[model samples]
Target: MTHDSTGLRRLLLVVADGVRHDVLADEMDAGRTPALAALRARGSFHAVTSSFPSGTGPAYVPFLMGRHPARVGLPGLRWYDRARSLSWAPAQARSYAGIDIWHVDGDVHADVPTLLDLARPSLAGMSMLGRGAKHGRIGRSVAWMLRAAPSHFRGDLLGWRRVEQQATGAFLSRFAAVRPKVSVLAITSPDKFAHAYGSDSAPVRAAIGDLDAAVAQAQAIAVRDGWRDALHVWVVGDHGHAPVSQHDDLHGWLEAEGLRVLAHPRLHVRDPDVALMVGGNAMAHLYLSPGERTRRWWPTHAARWGATLDALLARPSVDLVATASSATTVEVRHATRGAAVVQRRESPTGPRWSYLTTTGDPLELGDSLHDLDAGTAWEATSATPYPDALVQLSWLATAPRAGDLIVSASPDWDLRARFEPVSHVSTHGALLRPQMLVPLLVDLPVTRPPHRTADVVPSALDLLGISCTTDFDGRSFLRGTPVSAAG
Candidate 1:
C-alpha cells in the first residue's frame, strides 16, 4: 500500500486567512519581517481581489479550485441549502473537526477538480475540500489539544493558535519525509485574532508577527528538506478584514418593514412565507419560500422583490444590492454609488460586459461606455467600487443557489440577523475594497499580473510545467510574453 514519493519539487501554498494586505505590507516595510522582505525582493507581489462576499469559505474556492465559488453555489459563511432542505453555518462550526457544510462529498459535488486533486499525494491542513490530512492524525491532535489545554481549547484565541501551529507543523514534518507534489498550510491565527480583536488591534498585530515567523519556518523546512530552490512558496491571504462600527439588524429592519422572515426549518415541503438566510456577517442572501418559487408567480413577485430591494438600499447601513436583471445581466444599486446596470456581451477580444450609469455616483469611477471600446469595456469592468466588481457580481446574480437577492453591508457596518451573532470587531464578507483586496506574493515574475484569488493556482500550475486542458475561470499569468489586451 506504499506510494512513491514525488521528491521535493512541489508547490507549498500558505494561506494566511483574513490577513489584510496593508497590515502585512506595513509590517514588511517596517523591517519587522526579514523573511517576507526577502521573498518580496526575489519575487513579485500583487494586490489581487478576493472572491465576492469575501468570506473565507467562498474565498478558499478560488485558491483551491481556480474558479468563482458562485459556480458551485457556495453561499458565504452561512446559508440555507434548498437542495438539502437544511441550513448551514460554515464559519462557526461547533467542533474543531469542522462539519461538512456542503453536507456532500467534496470530489463528487465540486464543480471542478480542486488544486489538491491536480497534484496528488498532497497534504492539506484545516481544509474542508479535496483530501486534507488523514483523519486519524487530526483526531488525535484535537484530542491531545483538548486535554492539554481544556480551558483554552474551545474559545480561547491564543490556545487555538498554538494548537493550530502545532498540528500544521506536525503534519508538515511528517509529510516532508514523503515529499508530496503539493502542500497547503492554512494559518488561521491572523483570522481568529482579527475576528476576536479588531484587525488593527495590538493582539492582531502581534499575531501577524507570529504569522511572519510561521512563513519563515515553512521556508526553512523546505530548504532543509532540499526543496529550497525546487519549492515554489506562495504566501497569500484568503481575504482582508475591515473594521466595523455597528452590526445592522438587517432582518429586524425587514420585519419592521412588514416582511415575514422564515428563519426556522420547515418540517414539511410546503412553503409558509418569506425566508431570510443571512450568513457571512457582512452580507445577506434572501430566498423565497417553496410555494412562492413557481415561475407563474415570479413576474408579479419580481416587482415586490424590487420594492424590497429598493427599501433595503435606502437604509443608511446598507452598502450595495444586486439582483438578476436577465440571464446575462444584473442591476447593482449602491447606497452612495447609486444605481447601474451591467450586461454581458461578446466582443472581438473575448466575452465582456458593459455598464450604464442611471443615477448617483457610478459605483465605478471611470466612464466605461467611452466609444463602446472593447478594451475600455474590459478595463471598466476591472476599475470598480471593488476589484472585479462586474464579473463577480454577475456570477453571483446568475448563480441558482445565490439568494433571489444579495445585499452587502457598508464598510462601517455588518448585516446581523437574530441567529448569526456578530462577535468580530473587524470582519470581511462584504463588497468593500478592504475586504475584497488581498496580497499575492510569488518568487517569479508573472507575465500577466493576477487579479483575483482564482488566478493563483493557474499561475502556480504554469510554474510546475503542468498543462491544463479545462477552461479555468482564472487564466494563467505566468507566461513569458507580455499580456495582450484580452488578458
Candidate 2:
C-alpha cells in the first residue's frame, strides 16, 4: 500500500464479531477492558448500525469494500437465483455452509474493489473477505474445523479462539518481515460464543475479555514493529447478536403447507415451489412460486401471497415480512402491528426516499415520512428500532439475490428449526436494533460517526490519502471534511 505523504504509516483494523454495543460499553465503563478503554481514551467509540442481513457474509461488505450489502446484489449468505435455477442451469441455489465459503469472493460484483485491492501489501488474518490481500490469508481453514466441530459450544469455541490467537500471532511474527500497510484481523470467539450461549451470557462476556487480551497483544506488537506513532487502529464489529429461545420452522412450515422446499443437507426438492434460505436464523428468504420457480417481480403481486403472508405473520416467531414493491420500493407487513411501504425517487436535490403507512406503522417510525434526501433519510432512521431501514430496506427489496418474500424473526425467536445439527442460542442477521447495532471504535474523532459500517473503508482510504475509482455507498468522514457524495 503506497501512501503519498501521511503521518500514519499503517492502518490496522480489528473486527470483534457479534459484539453488542451495550455489552462492550458496560465492559469499558466497568474498567474491565483496559485495551478498549485505552483506545476509547485516545480515539472515539460510538454505536453504529451494520448493514442489512446482519450475517457475516453480507455484513462484511461494508467494512471490506465500502459498499452497501444490497448494492453488491448478494443480500444473504444463502440465496437461490430463480433465473438461473429455473432454467437449464439449475445450479444457482446455494447455502455457502461449509466448503462453499470460498465462492463468496467470486460472487461479489466484479467491478467493486476491496481494501485488499485499494490498499496493497495488506493482510487479512481471519478477516474472511480477503479477496485481494497478497501477504497471507488466515481463517479460511476454520471451515475445515467447522466440518469437524460443526460450530457448537463443545469444540468450535476453542477452535475459534485459536483462530483469533493465530491471527494475532501472525501479526506479531510477520509484521516485522512483511510490514503490511493495511491489516485487518478478525477476532471470532465472541461471535462463536454468542451463537453457542446467549449474547450476554457468561461465556460471551469472557470472550470479550479474551478480545481485550488480543487487542493488548496487537498494540504492543504494533508499537514494537515500527508503528508507535504512525498507526491508526479501528476496532469494530461486523454485527451484533440477540438472545433466542424459540425456533420457527420456516422451511418445515412451508412443506406442511403443501409447498416443496429446497433446503440444505438436502439441496434439492422435486418441482420445488418454495426456496427458503436463512441468515443468522433471525432473517429468512422465501422465494415462493406456483412451480414456475419464480423469484423476481413478486413485490407487485403481494396480493397473490396474502394467505401465506397472513399465516407467516400469525406464526409466533415471525416479526415482519418485506417484498419488493418495485425496483425502488418495498412492501412491509407485520403480524399485528401494521403495514407500510418504503419508496425511492429522484428529486431536484438528489435521489430522495419516502416511507408511508397505509395501515398501522409496521416500522413504528410513528408518522408517515415524506420525501427525504439520502442524508436526511440516513439521519431519520439511524436511531429507530430498525436502524437505517428506510434506505437499507429499499435497496434490499430490489436486490437480485434477495427473496421475493423476506422474513425477519421477532425477538427471542429464530426462523430455522430443523435440518441442522447445531442450534443457536443467540443470533443476528435481522433488521432489529440489537442485531444491526454494532460498536465502532476508531481513533478518528468526528462530530458524527457515520452511522453505516460501509463508511469505514472509504474513511480509511481518505486517511491514508489513497483514492479508488469504485463508487462507494459509504462516505468518508475524516480530515474534518465529508467524503464528497459524487466523488
Which candidate leads the pack in lDDT? Answer: 2
| lDDT of candidate 1 at residue 110, scale 0 to 100 | 46
Q: Give the per-residue lDDT of model 1 (tens digit) for 317-397.
A: 788887776666777887667778767765575556666777754466554352333234335555565767777777776
- Which 10 consecutive residues of model 2 have the lowest summed lDDT? 478-487
The per-prediction tally of clashing pairs is: 0, 0
- Candidate 2 has an lDDT of 0.76
Clashing pairs for model 1 are none
* Candidate 1, poorest ten consecutive residues by summed lDDT: 89-98
* Candidate 2 C-alpha lDDT tens digits along 1-487: 1222454457778887888988998898999899888878866888888888888877888999888876875788677776563222234575555555666777777788888888878887766577888787665655534533444324456655665666567655665567677888777778877887777877778888877886787667766875655566788888989989898888888889988788665565687777788978799888776245445576455667778888998988888899886788888889777889898997675577889998889988988899987678888887788988887888887887778888888999998887544568898888999999998887646645677888898888877678687777777767464323112
Which structure among the candidates has the greatest TM-score? Answer: 2
Please identify model 1 stretches exceeding 4 Å from their true place: 1-8, 85-111, 131-154, 264-272, 290-300, 335-337, 346-350, 359-362, 366-378, 381-384, 417-422, 481-487
Candidate 1's C-alpha lDDT?
Answer: 0.65
